[model samples]
Each structure stands twice: as C-alpha cells, then as structure tokens.
Target: MFAFFTRSIAAKLLVVTGVAIGLVLFLSNLVLISQTRDRVHALTMEQADAEAKSIAREVAGDIGELASAARTMAGVIGRGHEGQSFDRQGITNILKANLEQNPFAFGSWMAEEPGAIDGRKDDVKGQADLGANDDGIFTPYWSKDRNGAIQFSTFGAKYDAEWYALAAKSGKGAITAPYLAEGTDVPTTMSSIAYPVFSGGKMIGVSGVDISLLSLSDKLKALKPFETGRVLLVAQGQQWLVAPTDELLMKPYEEAGADALKTALSSGTGNLVPNLADANGEGFDRLLFPFAVPGVNTTWAVIIDIPHAAINAPVEAQTLMMIVGGLIVLGAVMMALFLAVRSIAQRPLHGLVGDVERMTKGDYASDVSNQDRQDEIGLVAKALDGFRHKLAESNMLAAEADAQRKAAEGERRRNEEERNQSASVQQHVVTALGSGLAQLSQGNLTYRIADEFPGE
Candidate 1:
C-alpha cells in the first residue's frame, strides 16, 4: 500500500486533497463551534432573563391586586370614620365582608387611635367589649381558620406589629416583611399591609389587610429554572417570602445558607449576580428583579437560580452533533476527490507507464498515448515519446554503418586475391626469365616475352 501510494500520482494527489479539505474543515468547524457555543450561551441567558421578567411581572400583578383590595377596605373605613364615631358593628361587618369577598385576603383589621372614637378614651380604656387596650386604643383583627371560618381577635399591644405604625407614619400604605402569623390554624407565612385613614386632617385610624405567602410560595416553588433550579421570592433583599423548601422560608439570605449573597443583596434592586455559591457551596447564577407590591409603595424581588451545567449540557450536545455532521461531509468530499483523481489522472498515468515499459523492452513502434493531454501526465508522455524517437534513429544509423563495413571488407578481399595472383605470375615469369637467361645468357629477352608478352 505504501509503495502504491508513493508511485501512484492519483493516490498522492487524492491524499493531499483529503488532507487539505480535512484541515480546512477542522479550522472552520473550530471557529463555528466557538461562535455557536457563545451564541447558545447568550441565547440561554436571554431566555433566563425573559423568564425572570415574566415571573416578576406576574408576581407584581398579584401584589397589585392585594394592594387594590386593601385600598378598597381603607376607603370604606375612611368614609365611615368621617362621621365622628366608630360604628362597632358596622366596622366589624365591613372587615368580615372584605375577607369573605376576596379569597386572597387572609385577614383584615382596623386599628384606631386613643380617644379617637366618640371622646371615650379613659372610660372604655382596657375594655374587652369595646376592643380597647390599656392605652384606650381599639384594634379589631378579623381572620380565617383552617376550615375557612371568620374568627374575631383583638390586637392588644400598641406596638405588637410594626406595620401599624409604619402605615400611620407613611400616611399612605405599608407592607410588612415575610413573617409567621401566629395563632392561625394553618400556621402559614404572610405579609401585612395597611393604609392610613384620615378624618378631618388628623390621623384617625389605620385599615389594613393580610396577604398569605402560601399560594405565592407554592406558585414560585413549582417554577424551576432550566428544570433544575428553584425560584425565590425575596422581600427587600432582607427576607425570604418564598423558598424552594419550607425550612428556608422567612429566613434571611445569610442564615439561609447564602452568606455569600451579601454583596448582591446590598447592591440593592435590579442587580443580577452570577457565579455565586449557595449555603451548600453549590454554584449558580441569581437574577434579582424587584417587582412592586400593589398597596405597599415598595418592591420585592424574585431570584431565579441557574446552574452552569444545565446551560452547557445542551450546547455541548449540539456541538457534538455539528462536528459529526461536518466530518461526514468531509468524508464525502474526500471520496469524490479520490474518484475524480482516479478518473482524470490515474488511468492516463497507467497508460503512459505501459508505453514506457514497452519502450524499455526496445519496442518503439507504438507512439506514447496522452502526449496531447495538457496535464503532467501528458508532459511525461511527450518527453518519453521524444526519447523513443531518438533511440529508434540511433538504432537505424547503427544498422546502416554495419552494412557499409561489410561491403568495404568484401572489396578489400577481392583486391587481395587479384594482387596475390599477379604476384605469383610475376614470380613465375621472373624464374622463367632467369632459367632462360642461364640457357641463353645470350637471348634472355625472348624468355621473358613468353611469360607476359602483351605489352612487349
């Protein structure tokens, strides 16, 4: 195989073309894969961003609905308080109806200022029937039990819940951080919101509604990013309203195994952080989107965790498929090039070789083929054909020279025979002349004239 490849022009050229094509494909595919990986990564990131925004928008809308309902409750309280006194039964009926009408409203309450109800501050102070505490403040809180029955309760301490004062302080509305609502049958986590009631330019009372995080958490917990990670509902970056599990609910990011999230949390709203580790040191990216709560005049954020592996897995699979396809194309192209070289180059070269072989055996009668071709094979054939002509001409000249040498030898032999015969006759004539001279020391001329007398 090695010898064949070395000797065959078609094989050499096919190998070269195959190598060149393979190299080009390798380089191009390298670039393509790099670009494709980057593009895929960018697209996935975009998808995650869009997903987060969508979730934030939906969560914001939900909070907005609760805020709207709270506003309606506050409006009713404001209108009733404008008349000078709190109608106990009427206010109780209103709070009850608000909770009943809006299924999402977990609880509703009205907290009043001391002496603000009918000038009876000390008289009804600490009276259980009037729902007043030691400070002569009346705060009636209405809520639901596990069976969904309306329950009556009174908030005794003036500062038991901060949402009460915050609402009055803000003079608009207030929202609480995620907190565990005690004394509830279901024992769910919830947020409190309140709107201040103004009567005659003085702060008369505060009307508020409690919203449950149970359904919201359930909604968020089911939403897994990349189907591998969970979403978190974080409030003001300080509290967790919803988490992947109940154990993480209402816990601060620090205690929730996210001590590394301090920088991102302090970075405030609208910040997206990547490459952070959870409490378990698991790496992931977090997209923090602050969505406004409807009644609170504040925004809470949603965080979606994205694992790096999930993003890379699909990209790697796609890249592998692309490389496989590219290799298949390369193989096909190389095969085509091999076939073309065989047809266009190898066959002609074979004919030229046979011609050379015939010439080597001294059979120069046939002209070399492919001499008129425009390729390297043609050039080789033309040169060999020229050599053949020269050798044949040299062989013809040798034959002519051999014939002339034979003719010259024949002529020389005839001249030698004629000389020998002439020499013998002259000797014979001389001897006869000598003998005649002896006999005729007197008439030797006549003896010589008998030997050869033509000239004489």
Candidate 2:
C-alpha cells in the first residue's frame, strides 16, 4: 500500500505538498507558541508582582503593629526599673502570645547590649548544649536589604546571625532580608521590627518580631496553575528568594536562577530559554519574564516550560488535511484529462466509420461533397469516393466488351447458313447438266425444255 501511494504522481505531489505545508505550519505554530508563552509569562509576572506587593503590604502592616507592641513593652519595662524588678514572665508571655497569633513569625524577643556578645561564641555554645541550654539566648531576625541574602540575628539552628550585626550597627528599627533556618533545610525571608528600651535617657535593650520566608513561598506557590510551571522570587542578579523546591529552585543566581532580570533590563520584555536536559536528560521549552515588585528596588521574575511535541499536534493535523485535499483535486484533474482525450480521439473515428459504411453499400454513385472537408476523416472519405468512381467505370467497360462479343458470334452464324444454301443449289445444277449432255449425245437435246424439272 505504501509503495503504490509513493509511486503515483498525484500521490508524490501530495506527499511533497504535505511536507512543505507541514514545515510551514510547524514553524508558524512554533512562533505562535513562543508568542503565547511570552504573553503568559508577562501576565503571570504581573500577577506575581501584584501578589508580592499585597503580601509585602500585609507584612509591613504586621511589622508596624509589632513595633507598636514592642514600644509599649519597652516603656513598661523601663518604667518598672530602679528598685522595681522587670516583669520577665509578662514579657515572655507577651512575646509567645504574639508569635502564636502570627504563624509566619519564627520567634521574637528583646535584647540589651546585643553587640557586646560574640555571635560565634553563642552559636558554638548552643550547638554544644544540643539545644538543652536556654540561657544567654538571642532572638534571630532579618534586616531589610535590597540585595537578597541570607541574614538573621542568631547563628543557632533557629535563626541566622549575619543580619543581627548589621541591624545592631545601623541602630535601625526594623530589618528585612532572605534567610535559611540553621537546622531545617527550608530557606526564607523575614521582616523584623525592633525598638530600643531606654533607661535614664540611655539605650538599654532592643525588642523585635520575626516573620518566616515560608509565608512568601506559600503565597507564590498558590499563584501557579501548572505542575511544571513555577513562580520564582529573584532579586535582580543576586539570588532566588522563593522557588518551587530544593531540587528545582534552591540555588545561587549562577546555578539555578532564571536569568529574567538580565533579559528584562536589556530587552524590556520576557525571554524564552529551553532546557536541554532535566534530571533524566529530558528537553523542554521554557519562558521567563522579569517584573519589578512594587515598593522595592529589587526585581522578580517568573519562568514557565512546555513540551514542544504537545504544541505541534494541531499543525500536523492541518497539514494532513491539506495533502488529502490536494490529492483529491489532482485525481479529479487527471480523470478529466483522460476523458477529454478519449472523446477527442473518438469523435473523428465516428465520422470515418459512417463514411466507410456508406461506401460498403454501393452508395458511392452519389456525390461525396462532404468528403472534401480538411480533416483526416474527410481525406479518407474523399479517397473512398475516388475508388468508387474508378470501380464503376471498369464495370461499364466490361459490360460493353461482353455485348460486342455476342454480336460478332451472331453475324458469323448467319454467314455460315448462306454459304450452305448456295453449296446445295450448285450441286443440284451439276447433276442435271451431266444428264442433259448425255441425252444430247443420244439425240435427246431437249433437257433444257423442262423448266420445272427437279434439276432446276
């Protein structure tokens, strides 16, 4: 079946057309898919930005509330000084209640003379105790930084300590930055609000609240619709603050981050990057878009990947349909051509047949005026007419020759009858003369006197 189809000209033409159309459609579909991917990425990034802004606004409000509570607590602690012991139980209870109310907060606490202690020494002591010791404790939190980096107040498993020193030196109220829990494998960003508790017009201690990066991750994860599609929280050229999972998104900017910021800053639009291989060496098409998060100098980007094979199904089907249609048209044309040639060849033959039939019936005596036409059939008819004329002339000549032969035979018989009659009369006369001469000699000379004699 395949061989037959391949051999026919119409089939071959259809195959060629099918291939050409398929290629054209394939390229068109690729362009369309890429464009669609870009549009989707742009829309997704816009939504991501709006989502991040909403969350950031909510976090900001929470920080403000925490700061207010910390200020009230610091005032209470300061006023209770000088012969009055601090209400440590009350302060701890308040911090625990606030932390429980906001699940996003990892921990919160107040510290006096934070810079006086060494963070490394505290971290080593905490690890040595295996979390059994609770004295000399410090609350861990992040300081606000546009450059996304892991930062916190403590070096223990519960909090990062890099942000603590910066916050302490800056003497700023609150700090926000990306971080990872010491013991746990999860990476996050925290927003911390710190207030100093004063004693006699001098700074005594700082109180603050901490929010986990998991909150941002949860919000971004909820925005994604596809299993393969992901929303990445990338800070310009630094790192991915929020990503899908450790295997898919947890990495430095040069490692696994979607380079959307570079593309957007350079081109002012989304860019597409195809993955040549996954963990299993599978290839996939991907799209990226960079978006500027509101109220933040740093930018964020989103990436999406799709299978090329799935996107090309419609074009293949359309190509097949076109090929089928072309083949049908070609078949129709060939059939028409065959019929036309047969009709043209048979029309003249019909006229020639009619002329031959007429000639067969001895009808050539009639004038063949129509035979003078200037076509092959007409030429045949004219030749037949000439042959018929010659035959008729030969027949007339043969009839005349036969009539002359019959007339000559009749004349010869008449002459032979006259000669026979004359011969009989002469014989009778000789016999009578002989008898008369003999009578004369015997004195009987009167033989001539008898006119009615049998001898005459």
Measured by lDDT, the strongest candidate is 1
**Predicted candidate 1 versus true structure: per-residue lDDT over 273-332, tens digit per residue:** 778676687777776666666668776777778877666787788778878988898889
Q: Which residue runs of candidate 1 sit more than 4 Å off their true CA positions? A: 1-5, 84-86, 118-137, 147-150, 158-160, 255-269, 277-283, 402-456
Q: After superposition, how far is residue 259 of candidate 2 from its true place, in Å?
A: 6.0
User: Each prediction's Cα lDDT score?
Assistant: 0.77, 0.52
Per-candidate TM-score against the hidden true structure: 0.80, 0.44
Q: What shift in Å separates residue 185 of candidate 1 from its native position after superposition?
A: 0.9
TM-score of 2: 0.44
Model 1: C-alpha RMSD to truth?
A: 5.3
CA lDDT of 295 in candidate 1?
62
